[model samples]
Target: MKAFRQANHDLNSEPESAASILQSVKEQELQFEQLTRELEAERQSVANQLERCKLGSETAR
Candidate 1:
């Protein structure tokens, strides 16, 4: 009877632990996606600035 009770308790805890881990993974994935978008936007801005500078120099020459 004691062994059965211990097994039942362990089984109950496993689902809760799995849910917590799943939630953490989801949050990290969301954060990673947001950072990726922001980095892309910054990269585009830098590229635009470089192009503008190149065009201005050609006009002066």
Candidate 2:
């Protein structure tokens, strides 16, 4: 396809474009990892709160 050839030509013409794309991908991956950690922390906090609530109800009874 003509579009594929044009894209290939563009990549071949600019080597730094590939490096720039690689850097962008690395940044996105780091951001994804950070978000995953934050989500896990939040989940743990919720679980702790639930366990405390259960303990409180049992003590009240």
Candidate 3:
């Protein structure tokens, strides 16, 4: 009976452990997505600046 109770307790804890791990994974994914967006925005801004510089140089020439 004691062994059965211990096994049941372990089984119950397993789901909670899995849930915590899954939550952490989800949070990490969100952080990665946010970082990707920020990087893309930065890339776009740089491209725009480069285009402006090219236009200014052409006008000067």
Candidate 4:
């Protein structure tokens, strides 16, 4: 029947749809990782600056 054929076609298309969704998820994960690394580096730089400021203040006192 035509309905059965349509159902079969839909079943076959499922894997391609799943693959596209999985690929998108992977790309988003990579972007998240890169953003996390950049944030960590920024935090470290800020911390270093604060420490330098503290040391400078202590020397002035």
Candidate 5:
């Protein structure tokens, strides 16, 4: 990709700045992954609760 090539060129020319940029990108990626996992867990929990409520209502009738 062109983005990767630019990053590579930057890393070659400005090692410290490139390293800082890479670290920031990594931190952002980790945060995004954590948020994604949390959202999935919450979604699964809500789905399970909804199923339980549906089953409970059916049993009452």
Candidate 6:
């Protein structure tokens, strides 16, 4: 009887466990997206700075 009750409890908890994992994955995905956008913006800023430096050198020469 104890074994049977344990099995039933496990079966009931499976859905809740799955739901918790799903929520964690969704939060991670949102964080990943925000990081990607920030990285792209940083990359663009660096490229612009490099271009300015190159133009400055050409003008000085």
Residue 52 error, candidate 1, Å: 0.5
Q: lDDT by residue for model 5 over 1-61, one digit each (tens)?
A: 9999999998888566768999999999999999999999999999999999999999999
Cα-lDDT of candidate 5: 0.95
Candidate 6's residue-wise lDDT over 2-60, tens digit each?
Answer: 99999999888765676899999999999999999999999999999999999999999
**Pairs of residues clashing in candidate 6:** none
In the order shown, the candidates' Cα RMSDs to the true structure are: 5.5, 2.9, 5.8, 4.9, 6.4, 4.4
| Backbone clash numbers for all candidates listed | 0, 0, 0, 0, 0, 0
Estimate the TM-score of every prediction: 0.72, 0.73, 0.73, 0.74, 0.72, 0.72
In model 6, the runs with Cα more than 4 Å from the true position are 1-16
TM-score of 3: 0.73
TM-score of candidate 4 on Cα atoms, chains taken together: 0.74
lDDT of 2 by residue, 13-38 (tens): 86777689999999999999999999
lDDT of candidates 1 onward, in order? 0.95, 0.96, 0.95, 0.95, 0.95, 0.95
Tens digit of per-residue lDDT, candidate 3, span 1-61: 9999999998887666768999999999999999999999999999999999999999999
Model 3, global lDDT: 0.95
Pairs clashing within candidate 5:
none
lDDT of 5 at 7: 93
Question: In candidate 4, what are the lDDT values of residues 18-61, reduced to their tens digit?
Answer: 68999999999999999999999999999999999999999999
Model 5 segments more than 4 A misplaced? 1-16
